[model samples]
Target: MGDTAVGPTDLGPGRRQPLDPLDCGGLELDGALDLLAAGELTVTGRMTDASNATLYCEIAAGESSGRCVYKPIRGERALWDFPDGTLAARELAAYEVSAALGLGIVPPTIMRDGPFGPGMVQLWIDTDVTVDLVALTRSDDPQLRRIALFDAVINNADRKGGHLLPAPSGRVHGIDHGVTFHAEGKLRTLLWTWRGRRLSAEETALLRGLAEQLTGDLGRRLEPLLTVTELTALDARLDDLLDTGRFPLPSGDWPPIPWPPF
Candidate 1:
C-alpha cells in the first residue's frame, strides 16, 4: 500500500488526523531537508500495511517541527533479488535523481539516523482527498508523463496508482521508491500512457542533462547507494531512451505492471 500522508478527510469519526503539511511547520525545500536530516526524530505511528516497517515520525529542530516517514534499515524484510538492507539507500538515491532532474515529484528525502537506526526519512505530503487516484492514473496528465519518464531513467520496479499523492497544492508527489535503480530492466509502472510515443523537446533535454550529470556529481552521490553494475545499466537506459527519443514499449520480459496496481 502507498504511504499516504494522512489528513482529516481520510479519518473516521473518532480517528486522529495526522498532521497536515502546514501543521507540520510548513518549510520550503531547504528548510524541510535540513529538518529531516538534523532534527530530533520521534516515532508517532506505523503503517502496518506497508511491506517494511514504515514509521510515521515527527521531527523538530528549534521551533520547526514536521511530520515525516521513516523506514529503518533493520526493519527491511529480505528480498531475494535485492541486497539486504539496501532499500533505504535506494530510496534516497531515487530522491537524488529526482532532485537532479529538477522534478519535484519526490518529497524531500534523506538517509539519516533514526530511533531504530539509519533509514530513509522524507517529508510527508498531504494529498487532495477529492482527486480520484484510479481515474488519475489512467489519465494522460502531463505530470504523470514526466513521472513515467523518471521511472524509465531510474528503473523503478513499482509505480502503482496508490503510490501517487496528488497534493492539495496541485503538485503530485510519488512515494515508495525502494525497488528502483536495479541493474536489469525492471520498470514496472501505471504511467504508460505515453508508451512508444515520441519524446517532447523538454523531455529529451532533461534526459541529456541527466546523462551528463550521471557522469559527474550525481554519479558520485549514487555510488554508495547502487552497485557499479546498476549504475552502468542506468547509463545504458538513458542512452537508449535518448537514442530512440520515445517512450519505451513493454519488453515482455517481466510483468509490465504491478499486481493490485492501485
Candidate 2:
C-alpha cells in the first residue's frame, strides 16, 4: 500500500447515560469520548469479511453505552506491505487526518486497550442503507466529491463501495482505513469519475486551509503517529494538489482503482 496525525485522547462526558437509539446520533460530539477509557465491552460475533479479525461490540460506561467496531492489533493478519502491528494505529491516524482536513468523512475513532489487546474503536454509523453505490460513484454530489479528494490526500489503498456509508443527515462516513496512509503513491479507489476536473474555488480554499494547519497543530499531532518519511510525503502531496487545482489522473505507474469497485 501507499504510505499517513494526532488528535484528542478523549471525547464523551457529561454524566454518561444510556442513549436512545436515535438520540445518540444527534448528541453533541464535543468531548463525547473522554469516558471511553473506562467502558465495559462485549463482543457480538458479527464481523466483516476483511482479512483481520474485526468485531462488533457494545460498550457500557456508567449508564451509557453504544455499539462500536473494534479491530485489535494482535488480531491483524500479517500484510506484505504495511508494517506488522501498526495497522490499528494507522486507522486512528486516518481519522485524525480526516478531522484535520475538516472533511468529517471518517467517524469518531479512538485507539485504546481492548479485550484483544490494543486496537481501534469507532462509533458505529447508522447508515441509510438505501444509498446506491453505482449512482454515487458517478454523481457529482459535493459530499461524494469531497470524499474523492479525501481518498487521494490520504493515499488510501481501499475505497471500496461498502466503505462509503451514508447516514440520515446526508453525511457519508468512510471506514476500513487500516490499509491507508502509506509513504508511497498507492491511492487505489473507486473515485476517478472526476479525474482531470478542476476543483471548485471553495474546495481549493479548504485545501489551502488544511495545508496551513499541517504545519502547526495538525503536524504536531501527527508526528507521534507516523514516520517522518510519511509526513514528508503528505506535505508533498498537498503541494502537488494545490499546484494542480484539479482532480488527479490515474498514474500510469501504479494501480488506480481498488478491487471490487462495488
| Candidate with best lDDT | 1
Q: Rate the local accuracy (lDDT) of all candidates.
A: 0.82, 0.74
Highest-TM-score candidate: 1
- Per-residue alpha-carbon lDDT of model 1 for 106-176, expressed as tens digits? 88787877788778898988878999999999899898998999999989899999899998767777899
TM-score each candidate.
0.90, 0.88
lDDT of 2 at 29: 49
In angstroms, give how far residue 38 of model 2 lies from its true place.
3.5
Candidate 1 TM-score over all chains jointly: 0.90
| Clash totals, every prediction | 0, 16
Candidate 2 — which residues are off by over 4 angstroms? 1-7, 10-26
